[model samples]
Target: MLRTVAVPLLDPTASFELGVLCEVFGIDRTEQGVPAFDYRVCGEHPGRPVRTTSGYAVVADHGFDVLADADLIALPASTNHADHPPQLLEALRAAFDRGAWVMSVCSGAFVLGAAGLLDGRRCTTHWRLTDELAAAYPQAVVEPDVLYVEDGRVLTSAGTAAGIDAALHLVRRELGSGVAATIARRMVVPPQRDGGQRQYVETPVPRCDADTLQPVLAWAVERLHEDLGVERLAREAVLSQRTFARRFRAETGTTPHSWVTGQRVLLARRLLEDTDLSVDEVARRSGLGTAAMLRHHFAAVVGTTPVGYRRTFRQTA
Candidate 1:
């Protein structure tokens, strides 16, 4: 259903983030069976160069007229400032009001906020700027620890490469997984990433050894059906319990419990996709201990229940 793709640029825009939108939709890749979009790079001033944040200039061939008819309107990163063009905000509000998919990359969420489109919507921006965005737009529900958040037709993504995740998610939701996978295969990127933006957020932790954990992690992965408590894992690694917990959290950017539970969820996802396993049996096989535990973890981490996931993604292979 997505046909026309329009990028609305602002002053002091980031080249790389804008480039991401162009790369995803600007090309003609029908030879690979991926549908091509009628892509337009537009700005308030047509045929004139706009200043970039990096002391560079980019010329957009189209003007604001392109956005009026777009199936998807994207806002790439710009200066994290509140001074957005008034007409740009109007265009954005109009796009959203009529049911077009509107997405923002990184600091671009500010632009959406300026447009009043993000008010009372669950949205996200770059983790670094989420607090600023929330403070500025108190009405918006800003999720600081998510890679992206979609409330209705509005999609907001985290910093840098996470735009690929948000865009591909839309493609998957609208066009099906096969098309999304085909596009990802051509792009040489993963079709999706697990976990939350918290995994990449800057935070302090005690220094820890990294070299020795590979074998331990591999061993634990193999025996996920068995108990993987910190005490048991520490005994297996021949370390004190407290030391093991700190080191594991430092290395994995998550607690031992969270990491092990995430691993079980992944294993359960594979079983759901590849085998005809019942919920209880899959939970038992994946070391989740029970179907209730599996359901809780699966829904929290993967955004779907076990049977729902299987029904959506079960493959013939």
Candidate 2:
């Protein structure tokens, strides 16, 4: 249902975020059985060099006209968000009004807010700027904790790697998780990940050491089907429950329960996609206990029940 993609270049673009869009949507992966987007990079002036905030410049082959035929329009972080080129904003508004999928990475959400597209939509940006986005666009519900938010065809993601998550999510939604997973594998990232900006904001990932909790995390990952409650995990880590909790908050940025639930949801998605497992079987395999419990968690975490999810992805193949 989606194919064409256009990324519009604004002045002083953040190179990494712009690069993220290009890597996700611009690359040709049809040889690998993935749908290749008709991708275009556009600027206000065709062939004019746009300077990046990182001290380099790049050029766009097309002008704003390229956006007209696009199924998706991606915005990257720009040097300026409060005031945008009128023509660019108008084009963005037209794309949104016509029901095209429009997404922004990092500070690029500011451009959507300025265009009035974010008004009354559930959106997000980098955690550091969520308050600014909310203050600037009072009509928008700015959720600061999540990696991304989808309200209709408009999507906004947080900083850096979070853009990958948001883009892969869209790909999975439109083209199925198989295609998304393929792209993710090629990119060497996960198709879907749990937790969010909350953990990162509270505590960044610490430098690894012998006493680091990564070994414990790896151990827990392999045993998601087992009882990994705090008590057991803490004892396995050879620390008091209180100390383990504190260190976990420091290292991973989320509680043990929230982290494990996310892992289970991911496993359920994998089972739904790659196995012909029934709801009860998937529930048991994913360690969620029952079909009813799996449905509740899967729907809450994945926005679809297990059966519906399986139906969507399985039918795609």
Per-model RMSD to reference: 8.6, 9.9
Write the residue-wise lDDT of candidate 2 on 52-163 in tens digits.
9999999999999988878899999875868788888888889988989999999999999988999989999999999988998999999987889999999999998899
lDDT of 1: 0.86
Give per-model TM-scores: 0.66, 0.65
Q: What are the per-residue Cα lDDT tens digits for candidate 1 across 247-280?
A: 8877878888887887888888889989998999
Q: Could you tell me which residue pairs clash in candidate 1?
A: none
Runs with alpha carbons beyond 4 Å of true place in candidate 1: 206-317
Please, what's the RMSD in Å of model 2?
9.9
